[model samples]
Target: MGNRTIIPFGPQHPVLPEPIHLDLVLDDETVVEAIPSIGYIHRGLEKLVEKKDYLQYTYVAERICGICSFMHGMGYCMSVESIMGVEIPERAAFLRTMWAELSRLQSHFLWMGLLADAFGFESLFMHAWRVRERILDIFEQTTGGRVIFSVCDIGGVRKDANAQALDKILSVMDTLEAETKELTQVFLNDSSVKHRTCGLGMLSGQDAIALGAVGPMARASGVDLDMRKLGYAAYGKLSFEPVVETAGDCYARTAVRIREIFQSIDLIRQCVRLMPEGDVIVKVKGNPDGEYFTRLEQPRGEVIYYSKANGTKFLDRVRVRTPTFANIPALLETLKGCTLADVPVLILTIDPCISCTER
Candidate 1:
């Protein structure tokens, strides 16, 4: 204990895509305590809601973070729709679900690549991102941008996936899933991954819930609260449950995400089979004059959007509660008594995108 020293891990970590600083107290490669720091990229996006019209704010919402861009847009739209008390067309809801699952698929792939990179698996990292890149290419063709696809509108989606393009997308996803399945063996069977992540950063179900952990973190810890089960958007028509793992270690989290990729593929396939035809979006004519809350299962965890409208183009107030922000307390708790070698891997498993929170 006398030899322990505290070190700053980030705000500009090489392995992390977003800026967040961790104060790690270490003694001979063992972590004694962990402290989290945020607010580096705070853009005050929520405050912008008061200035931008609900229709145009979709683009602003997408900027909350690149990985879960679709979820952010969808969440905002869902909340505002609740205020307006208007139901979107069934076809539009289904379209939102298809794209949301697609967002999750690519997000998990991107996280896998980042996880691989953290463990020094350069080839595996590239391999994972290769699959992610394929998805991004599809996103680009469909929504005109790969990272920040402003595809959601207040009533529904900004654009529709036509039959031919939708079919092509499904075919591409099928091939990607097959390739990803083969790679899963590499993560599960590799001794290096097991040694580094198997027993690292264990989070118990009680602690996860108490700390308000969301998404894969809570699911990995054995809590099964998936917002999709609430039947928002097209998810009500879909049949599935949240994936859970009892171990609550980095290995469990990795397994959960790998399984979710398969699930995403299944979800997209279902959307294609059950998709009906209708207008992609309906014009929202009036201003919001009520308070509403919306939640979604982003690839990282649960995301929340809240809005208060004053019957104007501008909202009275808007608040975004991101998963990474909520998971900070749990992360700090897990780092205690862990080896320094385990620090980066534990953080990677959470896929912390500080931009999602700080903004």
Candidate 2:
């Protein structure tokens, strides 16, 4: 073996959007092992359940992660609703599904931009984010808040999209679909992108399963796992398949996310077409007496929310298992045998959200 060196990659780095520290053990320029150290931005949001009432904690849950904020609030609310046996209105369920899919689109777009930036394709990065702004504009028009939408409540959504809003969403989807196809073509077909990503940071399907990879990371490796298939929210009514690629490399992972962007657009359209007419929320009475676990597919991957209540206003505990946390082990596995120069791209492939993981 060549002389070994240790390189630390990010609690803060130019490439990473969130704080995640990894100690990269290297023999010359190739990484031999990657040891992760989390908890840099641990805000102890889960413990806030003790102080915040179950209803009020929905906002707190939304604060867990900005990109997947809607799903975080929705997941927390779903847990409380399940525990209380509060069946939300059908219209509310469809609305939640629409927002969830929109969240996925924005997240995947942001990731594509970051990946483009990592490739040093400045124009491509700007083009990707410019498309993402349209999605955010839709969020602002519908939910009133672009990021931390307080629309999702304990029993159901706090707000409803009117006919005009729904029509606008459909129109926006039509435009975005065309725009995204053109944008993603560069990532999918560009020789430079393929040269940088193809066969790099490979993780076999078996290794991905063993390491507990989730979301695009697992799907890219042909693991065929998607929490949405469990029929949560309006997913049961929606017709779609999880995007998968068997190569289990950086290219495959990128491909999965790229396809998922279009999938999310289709899902939103379905939600609009099948939207029910009724009140958005049901009155949720009384405190939750038992614990319940809710799983939802966040943009990054599967997020599990566990809520325990003691028949009080405040919850006994709120625990969240974020996808980034689950995929860390798999990320370390991929880092091995990769050159130091490829580390940033490899890390971005997992789409790490340390804010979500460390929350």
* Structural similarity to truth (TM-score) of each candidate: 0.97, 0.98
Off by over 4 Å in 1: none
For model 2, what is the alpha-carbon lDDT of residue 196?
87
- Candidate 1: tens digits of C-alpha lDDT, residues 260-325: 999999999999899998888887778878999898888888888998888888888888988988
- The regions of model 2 sitting more than 4 angstroms off are none
> Native-vs-model 1 lDDT?
0.86
Clashing pairs counted in every model = 1, 0
Model 1 residue pairs with clashes: 215-301
Write one digit per residue (lDDT tens) for candidate 2, span 136-225.
999999999988899999888999899999999999999999999999999999999999899998899999889988999999999999
